[model samples]
Target chain A: MTRRRLQILMPWAVTLGLFALWEAFCKISGIEVFILPAPSDAWAAGVEFWPQLLEHSLQTLFTTTAGFVLAVGFGVLLGLAIGSSTLVYKGLYPVLVGFNSIPKVALVPVLVIWFGIGTVPAIITAFVISFFPIAVNVATGLATIEPELTDVLRSLGASRREILAKIGLPRAMPYLFASLKIAITLSFVGSVISETVASNSGIGYLMLAASSNYNVPLVFAGLLVVAFLGVLMYALMALVEGRMTGWAFRGTDLMS
Target chain B: MSDPEFHPADFMKPADFMGPADFIKVDGVDMTFSRGEEEVHALRGLDLSIPKGRFVAVVGPSGCGKSTLMRLLTGLAKPSAGTVTLEGAALRGPAKGVGMAFQNASLLPWRSTLSNVMLPFEIVAPHKRRLRANRAEYEARARALLKTVGLEAFADNQPWELSGGMQQRANVARAIVHEPRLMMLDEPFGALDAFTREELWSVMQALWMERGFTAVLITHDLREAVYLADEVLVMSARPGRIVHRQEIDLPRPRTLEMTYEPPFQAHVHSLRDHIQTVREAH
Candidate 1:
């Protein structure tokens, strides 16, 4: 195979080999099924609890998607507001940094109290955790425009709105998409954590119930679902990002 | 030696001064920039007046405020002590009739090249107001402009799909598609390779000649200035004052062949000497 194709396929082959070894070690050592189920056992558990697992998976997906979309919307708007004006950026930067530094997980109890146990608290938790990176990335993107480009636009008598639309937003897309990929994965984690702490729905709740009952295979199934969801969301985001900011990725091949 | 055809406004004026038929005037201008208690004098007592259809080039070293002058002329920056006037009116802010291009072709990557070129039409008034109703007409004009810059084939392509020279050409098309009377080019060819830069020089010259619009080109390359400008203004080092203004007595419709001639060499040598003196003085 060509080096490029080998590089691409090598990681998957390694991962598959590792999984096979893990299954063999578990079976040979005769580990308790409740402690560390084999991959086959986990798959069987998934098939048996398919209906409940599907429901919980859908709940996690919904909350994660809702939280991610809201975070992106608010984050981009806030970022633009902060990025465009020097005075506002300075004024809000310290407060934003302070808020971002606080452990967002600690706010779970407060969020549950405020939003109640269902999807609301979980979504809010995800939003709280994932919004900061998006805002920071977008603000950096918008603020870091080439001064010469702005000068050219200004001399063209372009209006402030035109500058924002043509220069600011387009330039920020790559950074925005990058932050989005990070934020989407975090959103899933946030949703699961919040669901574990507060909700009776979602993959997090399934894992918690399975662990209490000593159903290790079922717990593994729940984790597998979460992993699948995270990968799927991340892949979706990557696809969108590639479509939108493909131009940003060009011209980097020579450097690479 | 006054002829009847030569009006009083046409005679006895500084060769660089805008005659009665001129469109824009930069009167004795001074610009000083302050950053954290240190002041940098960028332009000092600068004056230049551009006739309606003349192509003027300003050549200077780095940080000599050639760009500052372009900004002042376009009203992007007001001179600290003097004024820029357009058609006898004081320019208080960015003149809507002015269009600009730069060394970096700042085309919006998300938009197609044709759409990028049509962007100004959607922002500037009259055109902006008419664009919605006459979208086809404006798109046609943008396409024609792109074609003139040899980028008609890439009209639908994103900015990244284009080469550096092609992107810069698209940038030029974007600047001029609005059909502005005054075009300000600040080192637009500085980022390109030697051959690409020379190629763009001709493209720009042809565009200016066809449009009959006044142009102010700010370049560090002496050959570029001599080849394209009707009058070349050389500014001194920081606290950049217009130290010398040389009218290119060379016949117009100047070709690349002229750049090799004795007169052309002399002009380039003389300008280089003056710039060296300015650099050494500072």
Candidate 2:
């Protein structure tokens, strides 16, 4: 009981400790609110601008989710294509890696020129930044199929399509779910970067606007919301992942 | 001789009738795998014939192409030099009536034990066509097979929840679920503990006796070969060929106590001696 309780409480305790240290350091150093606001100032700003903050939060969520959905659908299909064939994997993998390495921030300007100063650029940026992990993880899952399992299927006279539907896709679930956990955060980063650079709305734009007005407390509040949403989405992914892939990582307590 | 364009299922025999080539035959088959710039011969002109419903074991030293032979027999790999035929027709792609198990159970983690056992029904024909229409019947069949392997209670259990021996039992259940004409087991019991291995030997013995599915087991253990097989084929090292064939004359439904008898030990010793000589010949 104690071990389980500790496992649950340790992360929360450390998080509280880190916040406490940061708050104490800013206050003790006699830093001005304009320079580095304490946690209390940020909290007050959050409560004061709750309605505005909530609206901006929803906007960011909408764009990020839209982009992420596109990434997933595109990633899985592309991953299946790349993983199933040696020729496709070799021919396109280098180009994909090269594209991923070129920062999505650079693509934001080009997208803005195409779509022109709106949520579309942010959504596109989010998708461009995050889709790589999903593709790579899924391809890895497909490519690393067990030789024994393949032999088992092949010797039974299973067709190529049957093998993919039955074995390849199911085996890729853990990888797919794992990639979501990583890609969701990147999507958020992509959205915020584009928003800050050239968007009319969202928490990123709000932060950029507030910083220009010297509302350091509001800026910190915006930062806090981004972190909260990132953590929330990650925790949500982890929960769904636990449910879907219980057989892979956790063996004992499984869904019936 | 190599026929690069052998057709699949071209054998002119009915699905269920006594034919001239009633059993699987590997005649003049050779396997050579390429490594970098050089070609490495694994099996050379291997010829063997297995009677229907017979239990056969192939035992040889490491790198003796035992696994290569299994791949060829199951149509996973083409023999470099010769042909493999079931009922006198050449095998091209994966054979229609074959099932295989390996040292590891290789069950899909996401599937329940029953689902894993019923996997082949979703792929192999006749069953594939009837799967959706006869879902409950297939489920019942899977449950019955699991019961045969003493895994009836674990039908809904995740594969990892089962013990190693139990997992192997599930593997055996899965292999036979499709009702293949021939079952290939490549070192299926090699990973189990001595007690578990012997226990599974009994389970397998009962299965074979009841169903009488033709079995071809590849193993390094001479004792296991002698205990389970009606005939044990010994092979030489790389570029291997069948060096000796020993027929087990001991009676049906073999018990573990038989391994302790003077005759059983004598058979094991003689086979071991031949395998050792074959290994040293390289």
Candidate 3:
């Protein structure tokens, strides 16, 4: 009970301590807020521009989530295709690895060429960056099935389709959820990168515009919102993972 | 129906030598498994006859292709040479109307005990077609099978929640849930404690007495073979073939106490001696 409570509380304590130290150091040094806005300055900016912050935050959130949902849908299907057969696994795995290696930011200008310099490019960038992890994790899960399970299912006269449907997909679920948590945060990075490059309205665009106008407090406020939303989405995914795939969570000691 | 390229029946010279009435037969079979650059011959000249509704046990040393034999019976693997037939028909692919259980008690951890037991109904023939139409009936059938294996109370429990013995019991229930014509058990009780093993022995015996499926059990324990089987066959070391066959004429409803008697001990010792000889020879 104590451990569970400590797990939830400890990170907040650390965050508060770090912010306090940072705030104190800035006050003691008499650093200008333009150079490095204090936590108080960022907080004041956030409250002062609450409506504008929310509007832009919602834009960033929608684009990121749309791309993430696309990644999940496509990633699982691609993973299954690669994982189900040795032939497909060998043929396509290298291609996927090569694709994942290319920096997604480079794809932003290309996406801009295809779609205009706006939400579409941001959504595409989010998808390109986030989908790789989901695909790889799910593929790894299915490809490494227990031989005994296959033997039993086959000896029962289950077809390949049946085996994959009944066993392979369910076995990959924990991996899928784990990837979702990672991919969700990565999607935010993807969206912000594209937005910074070229987008009309999002926190990333707001930050870029504010920084250009020397609004340091507003820039810091945007950063806070992005981090806060990223962490919140990640926590949501972890909760869903606990509820949906708890059975797959074997003792961690066994994994080593 | 099996392979047209090589008819299994023709593999045996003098085909009628194996009585026509035999329910299952493996004739002059040879199974070879090849790795990257090396070939390992796992079975040779493996001939066997299982009469209808008989309980048979195969005992052999480790690395003696005992598992390979079980795999062949299930039609999971075809012989490199010769034939394996069930009820006078060639087993080409995975044999239909068959059930199998391994030593590991391979219940999918995510599923409840009853769901695991009902797994075959989701994949196998008429059951799969009938499942959506008769979900309640099939579930009742699964619960009944679990009851037979003394797992009725744990029907809704996850597999990991159960002890090893309890899981094995569920495994047994899963294997028999479809009411198959043949039951192939490979070291089903090999992992259990002595007391739990003996307890399951009675459970198996009761199940066999009631169901009367043709059971071909592959086990290393001679005592297990002699205690549960109507006839026990001792297998030679790798390139495994039946070396000796002992028919247990002991009366039915045999108790665990009978396993300690002179007659039962005699069968166990002889079977042990045969396996010991095969092991040493190899």
Give the poorly placed runs of model 2, Cα more than 4 Å off.
A251-256, B1-9, B13-22
lDDT of 2 at B167: 97
Q: What value does DockQ give for candidate 2?
A: 0.74
TM-score to native of every candidate shown:
0.90, 0.94, 0.93
Per-residue accuracy of model 3 over A95-125 as CA lDDT, tens digit each: 9899999999999999999998989999999
Report the number of clashing residue pairs per model.
0, 0, 0
lDDT of 2 by residue, A180-223 (tens): 99999999999999999999889899999989999999999999
Q: Give residue B119's lDDT in candidate 1 (0 to 100).
A: 82
**Candidate 1 lDDT score at position B113:** 92
Best by TM-score: 2
As a TM-score, model 2 comes out at: 0.94
lDDT of each residue in A24-122, candidate 1, tens digit only: 988999998988899889999999999999999999999999999999999999899888888889999999999888776778889888878878989
lDDT of 2 by residue, B1-282 (tens): 122443654776444433454578877888888999999999998988888899999999998889998888888888888777776667776776488999989999889999999999988888999999999999999998899889999999999889999999999999999888889999999999999999888888888888888899999999999999999999999898899999999987888999999989999999999988987788
Tens digit per residue, CA lDDT, model 1, B197-272: 8888889988988898888899989999999998898888887877888888898677888899999999999999
**Which lDDT value does model 3 have at B36?**
83
The better candidate by lDDT, 1 or 3, is 3
Q: How good is the docking of model 3, as DockQ?
A: 0.60
